[model samples]
Structure formats: C-alpha cells, structure tokens
Target: MEPFQWKQAAKGPSLFYLSSWMEGEALTAGFTGRDGGFSKAPWQSLNMGLHVNDDSKTVVRNRIAVTEALGWPFESWTCAEQVHGARVHIVSASERGRGRDVREDAILDADALITNEPGTLLASLYADCVPLYFYDPVHRAVGLAHAGWKGTVAQIARHTVEAMTAQYGSHPSELLAAIGPSIEDCCYEVDGPVISKVEPLLKELREGGASMAPNALIADANGRARINLKEINRQIMIKAGILPTCIELSQMCTGCRTDLFFSHRMEQGKTGRMASWIGMGRGEPFS
Candidate 1:
C-alpha cells in the first residue's frame, strides 16, 4: 500500500513480477517511464499517447523503441484506440495488423483486450489511470485492462478475469495479475460521489466492514477523498478469486512523478499516454 519504485537497472527497462503469477513461462511487462522515447518538451521521451498532440510518426517510433527494448518484435505488438468503456476484445492472429498501417483505423470503444496466441502482444494505453496485466500460464491466456476511476469502480479488472474464465476456462487460482504504474492516493484525490459509487464493492472485499464508507475514505483537505487506486484494484483482484500473492502492483503515482510519466490529471490533459501490456507466447520466451 505504500509508494514504491523500481530502480532503473543498467541493462534494460524496469522489469518486475507478481510472485504467484511470474511462475512457469517467460513474460516481460512494466510501464514506460519518461525516459527512452523520441518526443520532446511536454511529450518528452517514451510518450506512447498518439492523440496528445504528439506527432504520429514520433509515437510510432517511440512504440517501436519500447517493444524492441523488451526483446519483442515491433510488428507483433497490437494496440487499440481506447475509449474508456468496459468493452473487452479477444485478439486473434488475423487481427494482428488491425491498427498498424496508419492508413487503417484500429478497433475502437475497447478498454481491455486478451489473447491466447503466442507472440501476440496486447496493450492498452495509460496516462493517470491504472493499467493492469493478467496472465494464466495454466490456460495459456492473458488480458490487459485500463482502469480509470470509472473503470475501477466498474471492476473492469474483475470483468477481465471473468471474461478469461468464460472464454478460455482460466481459473483465478492459476492466474497472475500485475498492476502497472498509475496515480496513487498521495496524488489521486477524488470527490465523495466517486467514492460513494465504489464503497460497496470495497466494503464487500474488506469482509463487509464499515471502514470503507464514503466519508471514511474521503479527505478533509479538498472536501473530498484520496482513494488508493492500487489498493482498490488489488482488493478487486482478490475478490475476483485471484490470490493476493499472485498480484504485483507498481506503487508509483504518475501525477507525482510528472518528470518520469505522463499524468493527465497533473498536466491538465496536456500529456501523453504510457503503454501497459500482456501477451501469450507460443514458441519463444517473452523475454
């Protein structure tokens, strides 16, 4: 629940794991910090959001850099035009090049995506909202979700797991979840209305306790509350039947680290997006 950071290693990006989920297969995942991209100024480096006033070409180049840094081919990575809804897409080999050509528009109105095919990289962009990655090696399945407060309150992460189970027969006990970087409670203050909508679910996870009441979670400073997105998502994963030890969360707040990540809330909409992804590999290690 406390803020944490992944030290920048000399070899590559900040790679980490959810102990329960990191077992078995080889997979690499993490957020792209403000370093290692081709953008300048507000966009800075490693900016992955294309609609944030950054050059389209530059975003493509930046994305290639990110994919390559992970030892994955740029051509294999698949992205979507996020619309902040709960719609989930099941990516297939035929849909691999849906949005790469710039000449063709990518699938729209989806906030989450999953794939069971190897070498199929599925990703969802992020700014301040939390990015979650799911993997079920037992089922050879994986999922990615972008949870802004709306999506979080809607329990999109839980939805993804359920979708995986229904579609791919994934058992939560065998699933691994990773919560990527996002706005933390220290910097993610919110109003009472938002807290009111999500309190019931929070309460249910806390064993139906009263500590998660709307007023209890709100702060007096802004006459609102500062909800811990990381904690909220973690609790959702548990309630969805995911083992706590199977979840890995990045405790960094995007808003607080404007110099390292794009925070839409902190930057007031003048920021780029970060990419959080998950994929299943068929023949090679994800590494």
Candidate 2:
C-alpha cells in the first residue's frame, strides 16, 4: 500500500498524509500537493516556496492554507533555507516560525531540521528533491530533511539520524523514517559527476552487507546513469541503523506525476515547490 495517502478537501490545500504516523499521538506529518492555493502561472495554484520567484505574500497564504488544513497554527510553521548540505539544525522553541513567511528569517544554510519542541512545524520545500522524515516516538522528536542530489551525496540521512541521537537521545532503532515524493530513477537520469559521487556510496553499502535494490544505479552507454534516490536514501537510513521495516517509502514520482506534483526538471526549471512537514503538537487532534 502507498504510505503517503492523498486527501482532497473541498476548500483547502490538497495533501498526502503520512497516514501511519497520523495514527500516533498529536503528530502531524505529510507532503503538500500542487493544488488549492492562490499563485499564478508557472507557480500555478499552490506554490509553497518563497524564494522561487513566487510572490512572497501568495506563498505565505498558500502555506497558511496548508497549516489550517492540517489543523496546525500558521504561527507554528517553520523552515530552513535548504542549502543542500548535511548540516542538521536543532530547532528550539525560540526558533519556531522563523522562516514561515520570509527567506531571511529561516534557518540558514541547513538542509535538515529536527525538533523535540512540540507545536513547531518543521517544513522544507521541494520540487524533485527527496524529502526525508524522521520520528522518534520514544523521545518525541521529529525531523525533516531536504535531500537533493548534493545533500544525498553528503549523506544527509545519516546526519539527521546522528543529530537526533545526539540532541534528543533518540535511538535509531526507535526512529520511524520516511522517504517522500521525488523524481524516481525512471525520470531522473544523471551524468558522470553525479554517478561518480554516488558509486562509492553504493560500494560502501555493499561492503557493509546492506541489501540494496539491484537497479538502484542503472548505467547507460553515454556515461550516464539513472539513480533511484529514494532507495539510495533508504539504504543510507538502514546504514545509519534505522530498520527497513520501520521506513515508509512513497511511490509517487514528481517527474512522472506532474499533474499531482511540481517537477523542476520536467518543467524545465520554471516551477513552484511543494512542502514536506512534520511536527508534534500538544493534545492536538489529527485533522
């Protein structure tokens, strides 16, 4: 069964909830779609990114709409600048809602955001790049990571897990992880540079006795390869000590399903962004 289940509302942001996580206590986690907001062409209707040339006010409205739809307060919306690095910023109550509306106020130069602070919604924008989610029910900590090809090469998955372990005493064995919508290998082809960086990671996984998908990296005759980023991240999580059974991988591909998602590659770089959000709240019901 698909882990991120889409829920359409009559008048709100269309979203895919990480359904299994919703069954837990006061935790809201999911990805937004390209619908039910107020942005114009190129950004279309529901662009959630402020830095992508979308009107900042319109982007804020869309974001506020998502928060309302999730039954989360707009005041709790928080984010990072997402520099595609491995740095994980531990979000505190003081930093709550930092990047909710403006880029300058967001967590700087960090691709991963983790928090044990309830009511702080950690959001990271995405078009095709993978969204990595971490939840440690034992410690009541949650995290969101933006894993572009660069961040993946830097092992952001491992970094987030290690940060949660250090900051919140979270055991990776108790961490439930999820890989959200992104371009799949079917729609994501890469050149020598990307392949060079990814191959060593594959080698490391193989040497570490990890069972990776055989087609995780498929090569072509032109020194190019199709990479399954989600699977690669899944293997990275396993290498970082998260159990395979505890991880949920979304099957939706942004490139393949542009009708339901925004694809920077497919759209030739003129596109909006969706958001991946995760946070725990105080006695809040799952909306």
Candidate 3:
C-alpha cells in the first residue's frame, strides 16, 4: 500500500497525508501537491516556496492556506534555508514560525530540521529532491530533511537519525521514517562526478550487510547512471539502525507525475515547489 495517501478537499490545499502516522498519533505529516493555492505561471496555483521567484505575498498566502488546511497555526510554520548540506538544526519554541513567509527569516544553512516541540510545523520545499521524514513516537520528536543528490552524498538521512538521537534521546530503533515523492531513477540520470560519490555509499552499504539491488545504480556506456535515491536512503536508514519494516517509502515520482506534482527537472528548471511537513500537535490529530 502507498504510504503517502492523497486527499483532496472541495476548497483547500490538496495534500498527501502520511495515513499510518495520523491513524493513531497526534501528528500531521505529509507532502503537498501542486494545487489549491494562489500563484502565477511557472508557479501556477500552489507553489509553496518563497525562494522560487514567485510573488512573496502569494507564496505566503499559499503557505497560509496549507496551514489552514492542516488546521495548524500559520505562525507555527517553520522552515530552513536548505543548502543541500547535512546540517541539522534543532528547532525549539523560539525558532517556531521563523521562515513561514519570508526567505530571510528562515533557518540558515540547514537541510534538516528536528524538533520535539509540539505545534511547530517543520517544512522544507522540494521539486525533485527527496523529502525525508522521521518520527520518534517515544520521544515525541519529529524531523524533516531535504535530500537532493548533494545531501544524499553527505548522508543526510543518517545525519538526521543521529541528530535526533543526540538532541532528543531518540533511539533509531523507535524512529519511524518515510521517504517522500521525488524524481526516481526512471527520471534521475547523473554523470561521472555524481556517480562517483554514490559508489562509495553503495560499497558502504554492501559492507554493512545491506544488499544492493541491481537497479540501485544502472550505468550506461556514457559514464552516466540512473540512481534510485529512495532506495539508497532506505539502505542508509537501515545501516543507521532503523528497521527496514519500520520505514515507509513513497513510490510517487515527481518527474513522472507532472499533473499532480511540480518537477524541476521535468520542467527544465522552470517550476514551483511542493512542501513536506511533519509536526506533533497537542491533542487530536488534524488529518
């Protein structure tokens, strides 16, 4: 079964809820689609990123719409200036709502955001880059990481788990993880330099007892290869101590689903961005 299930409302942001997490936890965790908001052309309809040249006011409005749809306070929306690094920022009450509207207010130079503070919605913008989510029900902590090829090479997934463990005393065994929609191997092809970085990670996984699938890296004659980023991240999580059975991987490919998602690669760099959000709330679940 697909973990991130899409839910459309008559008049709100069309979002995918991490259904399993919402079923029994006071958590709102999921990704947004490219619909039900206010933005023009390239970013048409529901662009959630303020850094994408969309009108700042319009982007803020779309963000507000998402918060309204999720029943989270717009003031609780916190984000970071994703630099594609493995740096994880620990968000607290003071950092809540830092980057809700303006890019300048966003947390700086961090690709992952982790927090045990309830009611703080940690969001990161994405077009093709992977959205990695982590939830530690035991510590009531949540984390969101932006893993593009660069971040993946830096082992952002493992870094996120380690950060959660260090900051919140979260045991990786108790952390539930999810890899969200992104460009898959079918659509993500890379050159020598990128493949070079990924090779060592594959070696590490194999040495760590995690078997690599044949399709993990499909090489062509031109020194280029298609990489399965989600699987790579999954293996990294397992190598970092998360059980394979506890992780959820989304099969939705942004590159192949332009009708429902915004793909920077598919759109030739001209596109909007979707958001991945996960936050623990006070009492009842919003979704």
lDDT-wise, the better of 1 and 3 is 3
Model 2, stretches more than 4 Å misplaced?
282-287
Q: Model 1, range 103-188, lDDT digits (tens) per residue?
A: 24676778888888778777778888888888887888888999988888888898999999999999999998888788887787
lDDT, residue 130, candidate 2: 99
Worst 10 residues of 3 by lDDT: 278-287
lDDT of 2 at 25: 72
The estimated TM-scores of all candidates read 0.86, 0.98, 0.98
Candidate 3 Cα deviation (angstroms), residue 233: 0.3
In model 1, the runs with Cα more than 4 Å from the true position are 1-24, 101-104, 207-216, 282-287
Q: Give the distance in Å from residue 135's predicted Cα in candidate 3 to where it truly belongs.
A: 0.5
Candidate 2 lDDT, 31-62, residue by residue in tens: 99999899999998889999999899999999
Residue pairs clashing, model 3: none
Clashing pairs in 2: none
Which of the two candidates, 2 or 3, achieves a greater lDDT against the reference?
2
